[model samples]
Target: MPRAGRPASPLITRRAAADAALSLIDSGGLDGLSLQAVARVLGVSAPSLYHHFRDKEELLTQVARCFLEEIGHQQERWSDDWETRTIELSLATRRVALRHPNAAPLALRFFPRKLMLPAYERSLVDCPYPPQFHAVILEAVEKFTYGSALFAAAAEAHHTPAMPPVDEAHFPYLASAIAAAPASDEDLHVEALRALLDGFRVRYGPRQR
Candidate 1:
């Protein structure tokens, strides 16, 4: 039999590797991820992964970049209205985080600020806030959005109740507040965002410009 040329090395694109890493993260979280694990998922040897990723850390960084890219894509539909865009972007972040609760923490660990800055600058251009307050408003919105998404993801993963059991006798006020609160995290998240945006509008609305 004619000697078969050595089996062609499986072609592994950076995107494919990153996606496989993300899948591994979705199933097993950051802890269970390894170059070896990703390679297995791609049906290649661990060493082959080195051709694309120098190390596990680089692989993880790429995973985080990919995760953020997904959020960016989700936000592309945002309208030109600044307040509406803010709300849409925040919700999009939360939606993606909920989809991959296991990988959500990577967003915090390896935030690719450079990749995010351009979009933020565009948002600032559309913001009604005075020039001086643009940076602050942007920072505040981003901080709140990321924090809320992370908390929501953690709560979802742990099956945490929105309101814990409290004794009304000793903590009547707390109990009353809990009773009046929105039952679902999604409702509470929207309510809080609206309240936040309202405050921003009052403090930095067109009048301030």
Candidate 2:
């Protein structure tokens, strides 16, 4: 017997580490997430995770990258019209945020630019704004999408209503507006996207053919 070959160390791939971190986030939220926690999930020592992720921040960045990748997949089926695509992508982002409320904030802190550049380039192909203004338009859309998703996810996770109850006599107009608002978060997101796009169109006009 060849000296009972040293027991092989447990394998831990980058994808596996990221998956474990994401699961930890999903089950317990970010406060509970740690390299040690992820190692525990993978049944490996904390040092084992270091082979793939340098630190918890790196691991969390990978988690955010993976989350954005899900939305990227949805982009393949988006409408050809830029405005429509904007709404579709925004809603898709919102859906992912809602699904991973605990991990959603990572998007703000660590955007995976390399993973998203291709999709961003593609959006410009049919965009109605000039190349010079593409950044402005896209940035506005992206900011709104991220901000809206963050707010919506937090509210949903805490079981908070979009509009808390208000006294009708004290604020009749506001109360009436809230009463007439769309009943679902997605509906609200779409309405806001449309309004933002409409403003962009007005300011930029269509790109010169």
> Which candidate has the top score in lDDT?
2
Per-residue CA lDDT of candidate 2, range 1-209, in tens? Answer: 33466545547888889889989888898999999998888888999788888899899889988899888786556687888888888999999999988888898889888888888888888887778889998789889999999998888767797567899999999989878878877998899889998888788886557
lDDT of 1 by residue, 139-190 (tens): 7888999999998888776678545699999999999987898877877887
Q: How does residue 81 of candidate 1 score in lDDT? A: 85
Candidate 1 error regions (>4 Å)? 1-10, 206-209
List residue ranges in candidate 2 displaced over 4 A. Answer: 1-10, 206-209
**Model 1 — TM-score against the truth?**
0.89
lDDT of each: 0.85, 0.86
**TM-score (all chains, Cα) for each model:** 0.89, 0.88
Estimate candidate 1's alpha-carbon lDDT, on a 0 to 1 scale: 0.85
In candidate 2, what residue range of length 10 has the lowest lDDT sum?
Answer: 1-10
